[model samples]
Target chain A: MEDTNSTIYALKTSAGQERNVARLLARKARTIDGIGISSILVPESLKGYILVESSTKIDLRNPDLKVQHLRGVVEGSVGITFDEVKRFLKPEPIISSIQKGSIVELISGPFKGERAKVVRIDESREEVVLELIEAAVPIPVTVKADQIRIIQKEAD
Target chain B: MKACTVCKMISSKDHCPSCGNPTSDNWSGLLIITDPEESRVAKELNIEIPGEYCLRVR
Candidate 1:
């Protein structure tokens, strides 16, 4: 799925506003003629930037396409390759990086904000068995992988 | 926003307007196709409609 004709450019945007910027750019590209903006990508893992695919270089200073939260094109950028954008296109599962005995912080549910040690991982279910570090007794609590953030990796 | 399970098109409806598939709220990555005819990304993803889409839907 490589495209040699169109070049991928990174557009800087305000943090937490990548979706808004992409939406605005999409609307502008449709209304304004000859902007050459083909597609806009807002990857969850990639923050503070959005990818724009175009046949030619985009002029961000164009008054007609002034979109809020859109800063400008990345400096010294000569377009990104398809290989670079491939990871964003198909992101790996959140549990792929987690390991047993890793220290994690729960971000949601009844155990929200609690620190825990990963005891076991069920890849098929996408759930993790964790032992709360702050609890009095070592009780295993199962949680969805997405609800926990890895705080420290288990020492090799 | 919800994403169609079949087409991955992002919308607020329970079913996709284009493909008539059930929509899911568990989705990641945003892809907006402004011009599908000119977009190489759109072509690679095989998206014909010009609209917001999700790269991954669960």
Candidate 2:
């Protein structure tokens, strides 16, 4: 499990049954009062584990009847636990507009902090292809759209 | 230069309509795909026929 702003814990289960546990956990989480299911990324691997996204902390550590019931659902040993789902939920920053001739500053790359003109925009992937005017080669470059900040044009 | 959506090439308008790629007004950042041969992104992404490419287009 990944360790980031979100905490991801391990739940013991038979090999090749991680996906089943994930699905069952999602269902159970949904039924739990005040626990809202956000997203799940169940990879196709025995070592894989379920990812549950929620704002409030969950009580999956109970070793009582709920654990046995969860195990029965999977036909194997099971214990509901936590995994780093916060990384998956980390929000991507937003932007307003990207247009031609707009001045921008490169946030990352060999030309980090350098300014360039916005010649084209790829809205789908949220990246910008820029042409370096000050550089000797004046070559074009591509970078994530969030990497740049629009330079507000001033009155001529 | 009118950018070819598929090829990312900057060419004269009404000519060189990128025969294989896509075109759209939604392109965000304009980047020249210079040195597509040496560029890691170009090689990994299999982008050929260099030109202006939208870095991020909706």
Candidate 3:
């Protein structure tokens, strides 16, 4: 969404330090004069970058706001649109995309790092029944939907 | 850290400092609003207070 007065600018930050840069920038924006930073967004999906809403372009040269992990503002005259960032604002449930017969890798718990095939999905409970791909016996294992990452979808 | 179910503001206490709503540890995404009035992002999310907030709270 475009506002008449303010624009959204993307700031390049060091990987794994988006939150730190955003926090430091917010603190600095409050103390410094003429820095019209309105908001800071650190989307988990977008690493090494944070979006900043301001009335004018942020001046990182100001020593007060020189965050340690901040690389610089993204080079572009045109600011990012609200539509472009909307997807990150409200993330969809992880379970919605998972389907039966999909290949997945266990991300957490005792079966971590094991590849498995999705057998059944319990949408209400957000759980999935998976069969270990490498196991000698086809044992059905139940896991939380979030515990597995989809590796491949079942062919139509 | 816990997030208030009502306002989604991140805090250490059980209840939200601003809304007094119960907070949950299961929350994700970090949004910081510095200027509620001038921020379009904050407006879209319906966030009024300027503080740390989570995008999703379970």
Candidate 4:
């Protein structure tokens, strides 16, 4: 059941109007016929451009697209792959200042006010696996990197 | 030593008390939400505890 309407295209909309245009496109797709639109995304890091995944190339002159004064895709660029947007879509860690063996305090989770040691770092999830040094059993818990404070450094 | 970029809670401890997001010394605008339930701005920002907070964290 492969669908022909599976290509992703880009649109040039006004900066900060991305969400609005996305909402409009979503609504139009639901009510219009042969819109062939599958999904729409407006990345925060990127402004003035919205990515639209659809089976067919959207017509800029289509009234349902609400392209009044809103820009559309450029010529010779009708399809884009995941790799094209991956660079801008990837998420970076919230707190990259942490180091291994550093003593950190659990500040917000169930183990609030408790201290722990950095056991491992999971940069992809922006989380850290910590060994609770203050606990009787020394439980290991994974939490957001920002959830723990570096109480002491390994050097000290 | 840092404050949460999301919740803006400041701490010598390095983590935010409200939200578990990262806290950084790279924050500006000091604030204290003692009554997150009563303070309009605190409620607006989703702060729910009495603690030192910063307005912006980079």
lDDT of 4 at A153: 78
Scored on chain A only, each candidate's TM-score is: 0.90, 0.37, 0.89, 0.55
Q: Give DockQ per model, in order.
A: 0.73, 0.02, 0.78, 0.02
Name the 10 consecutive residues with the lowest summed lDDT in model 2 chain A. A1-10
Clashing pairs in 1: none
Error of 1 at A12 (Å): 1.0
Error of 3 at A40 (Å): 0.5
TM-score of 2: 0.29
Q: A1-156 in candidate 3: lDDT tens per residue?
A: 445487788899999998889899899778777788988998877889999888877777877668898998897766787888788889987889998899999999999999999999998877999999999999999998878999999857
Q: What local distance difference test score does each model get?
A: 0.89, 0.49, 0.88, 0.66
Candidate 1: segments with Cα more than 4 A from true spot: A1-4
DockQ for candidate 4, please give it.
0.02
Q: Give residue A109's error in model 4 in angstroms.
A: 23
Q: lDDT of model 1 at residue A95?
A: 91
Candidate 2 regions exceeding 4 Å error are A1-96, A153-156, B1-58
**What would the per-residue lDDT of candidate 1 be over residues A37-126, giving only the tens digit for each residue?**
889999998899999998777777778668999888886745587878878887899999999999999999998999999999999888
Clashes of 1: 0
Sort by DockQ, top down from the best = 3, 1, 2, 4
On lDDT, the stronger of 2 and 3 is 3
Weakest 10 consecutive residues of candidate 4 chain A by summed lDDT: A85-94
Positional deviation of residue A120's Cα in model 1 after best superposition, in angstroms: 2.5
Q: Place model 3 in a CAPRI quality band.
A: medium
